[model samples]
Target: MQFATEILTSFLAIIVPFVGVFLERGCGIDLLINVILCCFGYIPGIIHALYIILKY
Candidate 1:
């Protein structure tokens, strides 16, 4: 069950970047950073999202 949720979040992270982080952490600094990263480039946002998702 946890694995499935992680997988889904990972998919969302890759597809939409900060959205997964937003779902996981809600409105906060991480989400803000991710949004900024996304504004700069898609890859950074995806990377940050995956890191945050996997780490916490």
Candidate 2:
């Protein structure tokens, strides 16, 4: 589960930024947010991205 969380968070951290930028027009959750998310904890990041994914 930990490994899965790591992979998923990394994947979202990799792809979501560009998509977010494109969709939102130049601004989104910054890179620091991604790094902190992966480092501090994956669950928060996963939850946040999931909400973004599900909601929008």
Candidate 3:
């Protein structure tokens, strides 16, 4: 159930970028990098978010 919620949050994060990660992990360097990646491109941001979501 939690995993499903996380997946949904990750998908929704596509719109705002890194929001799901931030919500999951809170403020940190990883979040900063995600924000930067999001600035570069949406795909990178999504990839990074998935990595973070699955990693820990």
Candidate 4:
């Protein structure tokens, strides 16, 4: 379980910058959405990052 969380944290950390790029490219998503996701839960941030990567 701890390993899983570490993997998730690493994944999200890597994805944050890519998310910024997508947001900058005007993918039609708001930065606040990712910020909110981060605040709410790790899973949301992960999901949001994956979505950004796949979508943009």
Candidate 5:
């Protein structure tokens, strides 16, 4: 179950880092930050999501 959840989060991160970060750590300022990064650039968003998933 953990593996599946991680996989899902990774996929979500690639597509929408905002949702991925929110799912990983629940809704908060981080989610808003990620959304802003995503708007600025895709790479930043994906990197932030991966960092979030790996960090927590």
Candidate 6:
């Protein structure tokens, strides 16, 4: 289960940082905004995800 969760988190972090943020940081305005940014561009999503992970 732990392995699967890690894999899932890793995958989500790259392709869908909003989901990754939710998994790592919990639901909030930041999650919503990041999701929108992801829809706009993948790079921004990645940056947002990394920022969230590193920030907290």
Cα displacement (angstroms), candidate 3, residue 32, comes to: 0.3
Please report the candidate that would top TM-score against the real structure.
1
On residues 1-56, what C-alpha lDDT tens digit does candidate 2 reach at each position?
Answer: 95565456446534653333233233545434544565667666555454444444
Ranking by lDDT: 1, 5, 3, 6, 4, 2
Checking candidate 3 for backbone clashes, the offending pairs are none
lDDT of 6 by residue, 1-56 (tens): 97676667767788778878898878898898888888899899889887776665
The runs of at least 3 residues in candidate 1 whose Cα sits more than 4 Å from the true structure, single-residue gaps closed, are none
Residue 44 of candidate 1: its Cα lDDT? 95
* Candidate 6 TM-score, true structure as reference: 0.71
Q: Better model by lDDT, 3 or 4? A: 3
Those runs of model 4 whose alpha carbons end farther than 4 Å from true positions after fitting are 1-29
**1-56 in candidate 5: lDDT tens per residue?**
99999999999899888889999989887888899999999999999999999898
Q: What local lDDT score does residue 9 receive in model 6, on the 0 to 100 scale?
A: 79
Whole-model alpha-carbon lDDT for candidate 5: 0.91
Query: TM-score of the candidate numbered 5?
Result: 0.88
lDDT of each: 0.96, 0.47, 0.84, 0.58, 0.91, 0.81
Candidates ranked by TM-score: 1, 5, 3, 6, 4, 2
Q: Model 5 off-target regions past 4 Å?
A: none
Better of 2 and 5 by TM-score: 5
Candidate 6 weakest ten by summed lDDT:
2-11
RMSD of 6: 2.9
Clashing residue pairs in all predictions, respectively, total 0, 0, 0, 0, 0, 0
Candidate 6, superposed: residue stretches over 4 Å from native: 1-11
Please give the lDDT score for candidate 3.
Answer: 0.84
For residues 1-56, what per-residue lDDT tens digits would candidate 3 score against the true structure? 99798778777677666887898789999899999999999899988888887787
Total colliding residue pairs, candidate 3:
0
